[model samples]
Target: MSEVYGWEFSDGPGDHFAVTADHLFAGIWSRPELDLRERRLLLIGALTAQGQFDVAEIQLGAALRNGEFTADQLREMALFLCHYVGWPAGTALDGVVGKVVDQQRKSEQANKTK
Candidate 1:
């Protein structure tokens, strides 16, 4: 019962979709048998295939936090996308990955200083 946007599925349609999506994502993330690295890579590939850049970006961050992928891994994935999904899709992800990499670098630098 963590509150996500203060809305519950039992309330309404919008809430139902949001809650269901959240639960599904939680289930995927919490599957005990799947290794974190495998789960993250699958999620990244799925999101990329679906052309969901925003969600892919979020997943990329999660993957990085979970130690499933490094910034180089993400860049390589983007390049791979360029070959398979076309340059436009890969180009779009470039900015998202850059931002994530920058933020991660800053966070690491701050931690090192601490």
Candidate 2:
């Protein structure tokens, strides 16, 4: 089976949405013309462009964990976003991506220790 995170949110008030999103991501999102990495990048860029920092943070971490994007590539994407989305939005995205990278690194280290 494919790995999916964020369904951990399924025990709370948002369970319905979390399950629905899981289904979409594992099922329909995989049948698209675009590849997984490209789709991830699109979602990341869209979320960042809209200044959806919290949601983007989760996705950024997932993207990194899934090997869809490298930390350097994410930073480069943020710079690309800056030109189109304005400085403030891009700067906010940078902060979120940085946090997600740190979280990903810690998660990797923790897994290694286990």
Candidate 3:
């Protein structure tokens, strides 16, 4: 939600559609048909399959922060993805997930020491 690529809906032409799409998806996700964890797992699979690492990283981060997934579970998921998405995609996802877990640990430690 924080400025995507530093561009906001009021930034210029074509921005409106981007904002609209974001809002629409938010509303769609608000429905109770599916658990948020399930949606996040599906998104992680889709993004990883599509080789959308950056987007996948964001979703994975959310999954971690929200307690939807643990680091060990994510690593297991990455391994499971390898058979379907190929080693490179799975490896890239693992790298990103590892970094996210590391960041979370660092942040937690920092807070504890304060």
Candidate 4:
């Protein structure tokens, strides 16, 4: 969750969501059935269906950062899924992909300069 969402969470017992997330990370995500890349694709598709581009962008950015997807591939997925999701959602996804790719490239460049 932190890797994909750039989130920090308390390990305290009081944080129900944090505890649940930890369990999910340790259990569900560790299953060998579907790799993280495949799971990310599913999640992105679902998010697109719901017009949840903000969260989708987070997933897209993480996918790029983790080398799970190339910028071009992400863009292509957006274009392809737009047909299933509708024009407006697809357009939003395309724009988000562009933004995430640009941000990722900028971050990479900054790292190289250091």
lDDT of 2 by residue, 1-114 (tens): 144333343333667866876678667677768777777788888987788988888778877877888999999988899998899988899988889888888988999999
Which candidate tops TM-score?
Answer: 4
Q: lDDT per model, in order?
A: 0.72, 0.79, 0.80, 0.87
Q: How far is candidate 1 from the true structure (C-alpha RMSD, Å)?
A: 5.3
Single out the weakest 10-residue window by summed lDDT for candidate 2.
1-10
Give the candidate order by descending TM-score. Answer: 4, 3, 2, 1
Supply the global lDDT for candidate 1.
Answer: 0.72
State candidate 1's TM-score: 0.69
Report the lDDT tens digits of candidate 4 across residue range 1-114: 665454554575668877788788777776889998998999999999999999998899889988889999999999998899998999899999999999999999999999
The top-ranked prediction according to lDDT is 4
Selected candidate, larger lDDT, 1 vs 2:
2
TM-score, every prediction = 0.69, 0.78, 0.80, 0.87
Cα displacement (angstroms), candidate 1, residue 100, comes to 0.6
- Per-residue lDDT of 1-114 in model 1, one digit per residue for the tens? 122112233433667766776676467556779866777677676677678989887777766765678899889988887877778887777667888888888988999999
Looking at model 1, residue 54 earns an lDDT score of 90
Our model 2 lands, by Cα RMSD against the true structure, at 3.2
RMSD of each: 5.3, 3.2, 4.4, 2.3
